[model samples]
Target: MKIIAISNQKGGVAKTTTCLNLAAYISKKKKVLLIDCDKQANLTKNLGMEGAKTSINDLFLKRKFDVVNVRKNLDLIPSSVDFVGIDLLIQGELARESILKKALDRLESNYDFVFIDCPPDMNLVTVNALTASNYVIIPVQATQFSMDGVNIMIDFIGGIRESINPKLNLLGILVTHFDKRLKISKSIEQDFKDNNWEMALFKTRIRRNTAIENSQHKDYRMTIFEYDNQSKGALDYSNLAKEILKLIKNLN
Candidate 1:
């Protein structure tokens, strides 16, 4: 099984969007687990479940009661606002630093892909997510700070590879909330290319679509085929998924 962390230190970059739809699309054809490592519970809500205080925290801490099951190949470990406590927990208990990796170990054989939606922070929680991840999907908002808060992230990934997960590597960096007409977006996109990080840039950039934002407000994540199914958003993510699967298949 391949475990990927959908993360970035930047918020509002559609990190949640990428995680939700990617999980949904993959589940359409295979067994998938969408882990809500974020405290916001957005991923859990999209799955039509509410946050359970004892949910992800329970699994991360290795509670005996934590168990995973599936309905039609999509299983999720819910998270709630209470998960903010998990950050402190992970820091205080060095023994639990690798808790997420251990929890995933128990469920690996049953899943084809395990997607973790990480909070937009570089803390103990992110450390656990990164350490457990086989791949990292960095979502960048195509606006001004598109590349602003990336250095710390790069440094953290480097440190993790050196000390924790040497096999972990970047899956891609997708540009989100893009407005092609904007000079700012265009400039940053160029900046990204100049830095030689385009290897993961998808040809189908997710443009700023009202439909995509609307789906989030309505608390749903439509597959690229579902979100304006014929719109660029759907098509782009579908193409992105194809690119992702090519790499995932290579792993097996």
Candidate 2:
């Protein structure tokens, strides 16, 4: 199975949203597993699985844990708010950086893809996720600050590859909340081109849309495809899924 981590050291960059929708779309034809590695449990809460007895924390703590099937061919290992303090607890463990890899090694080989939703921090949990992943997708907003975070995250991923998983590769930098009408957005897109980031940037940009936000609302809690299949948000993610599949196929 190919494991991909959705990560960005900055919040509001659509890491969780990307993880949720991308996995949902891919799981339509391929078995996908999602691991919520954020302490906020936004992914878990978004899926309405906050009350799950087993969580990603249980896996980190080496406790008995089970995956919950959230949809057809889609399974989730939810996160817990208790994970906020898990870093302190696992810091003293042996081979802490590889704990997540070891946990995943014990799981049954039943997934075509595993998507990990990492927290918006360069902490031990994020390190563990990187070590366990084969590839990473960094989501960024069309802002200078988000571009700064992308640089920091690239350096961080380099460290993880040099020290931990040499096989880990950057899948791409995804542009989210993009608005072509906004000058800042257009500037950022130009900035990416000027810096020769086109090689690493995904061609598909996730446009800013109210439908995308409403789909994630507590009352709705729907995937983009489920909420509005014809929406731009849905179309972008669908194209992204196709792009990713083609990229991975070429890589392999």
The root-mean-square deviation over C-alpha atoms between each candidate and the true structure, in angstroms, is 2.3, 1.2
- Taking the tens digit of each residue's C-alpha lDDT, what string does model 2 give over 175-228? 999888888888876777776777898989889988889999999999999999
Q: What are the per-residue Cα lDDT tens digits for candidate 1 across 1-252?
A: 999998898778888888877777778898888888888888777655674445887766655335344346888788877788677766767555578887787776888988889987887888888889999988888875545576567777889999988989887777788898988878876777787866667665777877766666655544455556777677667777887998777866
Span of 10 residues, lowest total lDDT, candidate 1: 62-71
- Which is the leading candidate under TM-score? 2
TM-score of 2: 0.97
What value does the lDDT take at residue 179 in candidate 2? 88
Weakest lDDT window of 10 consecutive positions for candidate 2:
142-151
Q: Give lDDT per model, in order.
A: 0.76, 0.91
